[model samples]
Target: SALNLQLMSLTLFDVFGAALGVFVVLTVCKFVEEELSNINMPEMKGKEGRFQYTITDVKITELNLTHADLQFIPEVGLLFDVQNSSITLSFHRRILYWFFYDTGNINASAEGVNINTILNLIRDDDGRLKINNITCDARIDKMKAQFSGTLGRVYDFLASFLTSGMRFLLNQRICPALNHAALVHVNSMLETIPVRTEVDQYIGIDYSLIDDPVVTSRSLDMNFRGMFFDLSHQNDTLVNYAVDPVIREYDRMVYLALSEFFFDSGMFSYFTAGIFQMDIVNEKMPKDLEMLLRTTYFGAIMMLNPALVEAPLSLQLAVNSPPKTSIKTSGATVVMTAIVKVMVLPPGQPPVQLSSMTMVYTHIHTSFFYFFRILLDFFDSNIFKIFSNQSALESLALIPLQAPLKTMLQMSVVPLINNWTKRGVQIPLADGMDFIEEVVEYHNGFIVIGANLHFSKGLREMISVMPPPHMAVYVEPTEALPYDSDITD
Candidate 1:
């Protein structure tokens, strides 16, 4: 009976070992599946009603490829290359019951991995960013996988032989699998990240590449020739007019050079039509001004303020701003100057008009108060002086109006201009790219943004399904091109 019991115990142990092997393999597969499944990218798509870019012809040049964990110098003028790269990875678990001293190890190795790729940036006819002239070669030199435990020395010996066979199978499969995986990622990135964004209903972004991008050992250089458009005034006299030195600086990753922009005079005509107008009527005025309105010297005031009449009075208010715009910038700030006009129209009298130029300076990124906040400053308004010379009564009445009028203009009109500067005109070219830093500038008629795109640190781990032992090697420092200008410090 004891002999039979021992036989049954041995049989049970064998079954358990087999079951444990199955569990280990299944666990590895599940881990990989879970990791890949968690890559949700929908958030990269911009929210509705937010500005989104539809980038076209994004020409990336001179991309540097390196292992996520390794770094070494390369030969001069040679693009960094990977050849016969190898990776070794292992996972271990301990069994503490009947197989108390046993440890399970799952080991994987890859050798002779090689890849070369070249691509061109272009926009399709439909205005989508496209990779053109793509050419790539990927190959796995060798691959091996093994599962080993405390079965016996014989099992370990056999595992090595089986691993060789598995390596061949994996080698045959890894190349296609790797290429497919990379394609999936690239397609996802292009699909979700917009290249052309709407600054507003009336403005749009143009990011077409103006010249071929240059690649060096250290960085890729991209030259862009794009500007903003005012949709409502396409045919204005100065719409297409621009001066020379369109791109004056290229010191950072993003640059902007703006020469001039024209706003149609009619853009502010609503202000001229009495949107800011108020009637001066005796019924609504202070007793002092009301008594003064009844006198001959104040009779003119009665015309403007019909409330002064014995019968119910009728009055009309009209306000306007004539259109001319000039814009300049200094140290993260923009100053804008515009001419404005105000008019008062009585039921039967000629319209009275007053004119002045309103200058506003907006400081970008100047404070810590609001998220992405900007400062607005109104400098030296003498609008009331125009009313002062007309007459004493006119001057007295109009002086009180200036404060409210200034507040209204500052609240309503200045913000629109500020928004135009922040969203419509400024371009954040490097923000969304996975590996990029940018400096932005503006000049004559173009936006000159110098961008640096490279292999970011830890990129290998980000894309790896499991951690592997390897270091990047042969990373070469990039040489500056003849045309390269370090305008940014």
Candidate 2:
């Protein structure tokens, strides 16, 4: 029980500049700037002696994230430092000048923004990424305003008082807006990661976190359930009985290690759901193979039906059990037991079985390393190219169907399985995040995938150009932006 039975481990290595920076500069960080821009500042009202006035319709009209940097706080979470940003806003000003009332519009602008946020990350009770709390500190450096619509000279006199009040009120709204977005909106996005979800009608996957993520000075490590279930039979789950997958290398942006349990569970689910069965008809089979099938089953067909001898041949294959995945330093192998049936179908009649054969189809699973399969050799069906150092399959089938059956499997059933697996499984990722530069390394009983992470365009594209990560730019909590950080930043 004390052993670390981690089936899958995901790591964000210590030096997370590219993807993380891009994400901060593109998605979440960009979202922060937007939250600041969309801030709904409260109205400002004051009375100077007999002159009283109110500033309403207070809203930011423009903002820019000139320069932003993200840093880890060791024991804490992330610190988003938003620097020198440009912001602009507009408001409706109504003044009661000793009973003589007048209304006008005041457009305000500020330069050199100052905002910092701390986001605390933790695993929730349900095993999803959760934001514990968010602390935001924000302000506007220097704000100025222009008045119009009936207040010419009077607007000049009240500019200092009016701008100061608007700037302070706007500053007060910044933290709440940013904090709400992180705790509510951004957390909602993280929640999109499936804890346990149906992959397809036949099977389901559980990517629930095994424990709280380990945050250290070097990296962030997360362990996951990495299990699957047969949807047809809810309890048809493969035990997490494989060796723990270990991640020793932290050279990439993301490092993923999956135990045999992660892959075996899926194979088991499909097998239990009866999805590992396929019927290859002559139409999809090659001409030469179809001819060989016809000749090979001719005698059996004659014995079954005297008049219906020219029926089209069909090869049905079903994996008899869940595939066993074995991984070693040399490579990995998928050992499977399958029953293949040779049949002939008359025009409208049901399939008439000719000869039933058991194929221990063993071929190298590409993902688990280059070890071979089990059904191919046991069925006396010698197919698939042998890899370096692996033993060759000894052909022992005297039925003169080994080569043809091999061809038939490759041509028809293989594609079917590929399509089925494509739709029934996924690599457990949320929207816009993808795995890249993936390198699969096989160990004793598990696989480690070293990869770089890629995040897509954030927010939307704008025509404005942004400086580099180190180059201080500008940020404002004022309005909508016209720049796409993913473009040039």
Candidate 3:
């Protein structure tokens, strides 16, 4: 019951995606098998000329389902709906005959008997394939006969019997066997598909919801989650990246969509993990700043605030909006804006909060090399000041520290920002597949992306060369009776 509930909650898209691949290979096979098996007629006998008839086997030499149309029902998920599908199949029947007066015995065979039909495919309540209907106006195109000995006029009866018996068989057996086989085959296939894949040491894809697929006239969509973990580091805070939104589609076989949220714990683990402190004794002034400080009173006054050699730095990252993702010809891109706050604790004084600064980070990742590159397009720090409360020192310095202070502040913090941007985050977009075409950012938080997979020519050729499903008869041998003569002796 628990397992059933779990499957019920899963998205239908994952099952459909995997099933589609298997369906392509089995479509023709199933079609032809149904066509041949439909010719199941009860045995017929005529005392006038002793004869025995039976279909030894049925084989489908040709089949085609590529032109079939697709249909979807959102209520039932992505059920397989096909119409006007056709097939060309052939089979064989064996026969035995004798003269009216037992003058001679005959053994014969019929080969190359052809059949054609149109098929309709559907799904049952259990999510298995069901062949609802089949329509065909076909007959045995050609039949080869191998005869040992035949009585006169018996040939006419044999031909008439073959025709009538085949027609009667088609009326009785084809639909039922076809429906049964389809259901069993599809259910078996569903068990083989994998619901999740580990991309690497740090990330994995969760396709558990893929069974609840969404389809429309445009394309198919499925929901999945990305599992991200940092094995080496332990943090008390956890980030929640689960966001639901209505994702829009643009083009391609865009099947998979995901939404990710950001958390402080995740950001801290990614960007900062060590003590960051700056003090007067430990601070190394820039060459130009140091030169200016020695030459002017303004630099002399700056020294009074004291270097942050012992001050402990506190870092906070605040996201203004959820990151937006989209696909480009090169690879996937994430555009986001964040405010970085830095606080310093001065010796014998309360902690001082620096000015709040905002930065827009645009990340471009390439599918080919799997490299992450971030571009800082905008930085807003209009009210940024290093020592805003030190007005007395500023008056004594004889010059305003706004311009020089801004330069010093930029020099101090920009490198740390750059280092975090360069080496902090990485997403392997092309982990297992050949390439990802594009990613779409939704109005909500969901992200839609299309994946491109490559199949080898050899594999395609092997599937084409495979023989269609066939029905064969195997009779068990009867056991010999015990010798009664030995017991009498």
Candidate 4:
């Protein structure tokens, strides 16, 4: 869709080097360890005059990635340096002679191994991240081969040759194992980022990337199609009329900016899905409110029929249009326009509409945005304005209904909408990571959210292998950014 192209100017995430460093320490290291756990090594055979032996069923069963460091290579890519790792393998060794032969299992291990690799990052055609190239160098400091059989002593005599040849073979496999992990497993993990996912029954959200990530000395900027769509009508998109949100600071782990369209589209989806409507009748309506409704519509009920006077009263509220949001440096203001229809339902008959009035709901968030709220006359002037009849006399008669109707909406309708929104929409993030200490600031036509990140697990939970001494990570304390700085009304 052209939605990404249209909203390409808006940034979705401004990830700093600090956040990326945590991700590498928490996720990539453990993942690579798991991916390189098992590697089958080719068989080796050697003959020298009367002494001959063949190694079969060779496999590296244990791998421990002890240390990993990531560095940015300016315009090139990321350099991955791994140190002090170890690999253990099991194999069947057979000794053959002119007339005598012996067979036994042997365990071999190599420690103090180091792997250096460069990972080239790129954006694929599908707008997903890809590692286009990987160049790896491996080094093994020491290798040990333990042999056991009836002729264990004889095998020990040739340990140097056995360990040397096997070390070379093991060195050959390191790059391929790392290559598979980066290109296949690591890239597969990136696919979990949501492109089009249903947030609830009525609406869906798109976190699809708009363009390739921009890498700089301090941060990585990514643009996305941050739009919500109606489930029943997926093709509809609210055009982004608001100014693009700007990222001014690079102090936090990440900064997320949302223009007004980011929120308007969510309201549009709910409106289009018919979720912005409610019907209150019978026990749901308060006794005093019902008394007011009956008293106000007494003349209309009498005109319809004397029997209709005892009919049950119903208050129906429906949003007339999509809600609009305004953002300023202080905070945000959300305004919604809805129409309320007063009606009555009689036994074995269709409900009859008695009267309808348009109501605008506005909530002031802060003093700075409160001033601009007055500037939008089209939204502010209609606050509680009511229209009941064509004649001036009929309009005067409906004056009693005005205050009560608005009060009922403020009490019931607003909370009903809030309860639905409280369920919270699912964000597009890798499992176990969540945002914390979020601070919102309003700008003209847009909003920004600056927040740090946290993981559900500590260092032990983050990795299956033993904890590394270099990084003993614990939960980060909540640290909010400066107020009056971010996104969404």
Give the alpha carbon lDDT tens digit for every residue of 150-219 in model 3: 4435455554444434333442344445444343333333323333444333322222442334444444
Best by TM-score: 4
Span of 10 residues, lowest total lDDT, candidate 2: 371-380
lDDT of the candidates, in the order given: 0.34, 0.67, 0.38, 0.67
**Candidate 4 off by > 4 Å:** 5-26, 57-64, 73-78, 84-92, 96-112, 121-127, 130-133, 141-157, 248-255, 279-284, 296-312, 343-355, 365-403, 415-419, 431-489
Tens-digit per-residue lDDT, 254-290, candidate 4? 6777776777788888889988899998887877888
Worst window of 10 by summed lDDT in candidate 3: 1-10
Sort the predicted structures by TM-score, highest score first: 4, 2, 1, 3
| Displacement of the residue 167 alpha carbon in candidate 2, Å | 3.9
Using lDDT as the yardstick, the better of models 1 and 2 is 2
All candidates' TM-scores?
Answer: 0.46, 0.72, 0.43, 0.73
lDDT tens string, model 1, 1-489? Answer: 111110000000111123332332233233223332232211111111222212111111111222211111122111212455554544343323333344556565656656443444444443334444434455555645565756534234433343343343333333333333334433333443344455456544444444334433332333333333344543222233333223333333233233332222212322233223445444543444334324433355445656434432222233333333333332222233333433334446565443232322332322111221211222223332224434466556555544554554454454544443343233332223231344444433322333433323222333353322234222222322211122111
Q: Evaluate model 1: give its lDDT.
A: 0.34
Tell me the tens digit of each residue's lDDT in model 2 across 1-489: 312368788887754376554654556566666777677666667666567778788777777777777666677877778889878888898888865888988887887788889888888887887788888888787777887876557657677666666666666677877776666665666666678888777777777786777776667788987777887787656666787777888667678787777767778887898878977775675788766655553454455676557777776778878888777777667677777666778788887866666776665544532221111111122333211111222223324666656666766677677665644345666666676667777788877877776666453221012222223233435532212223110
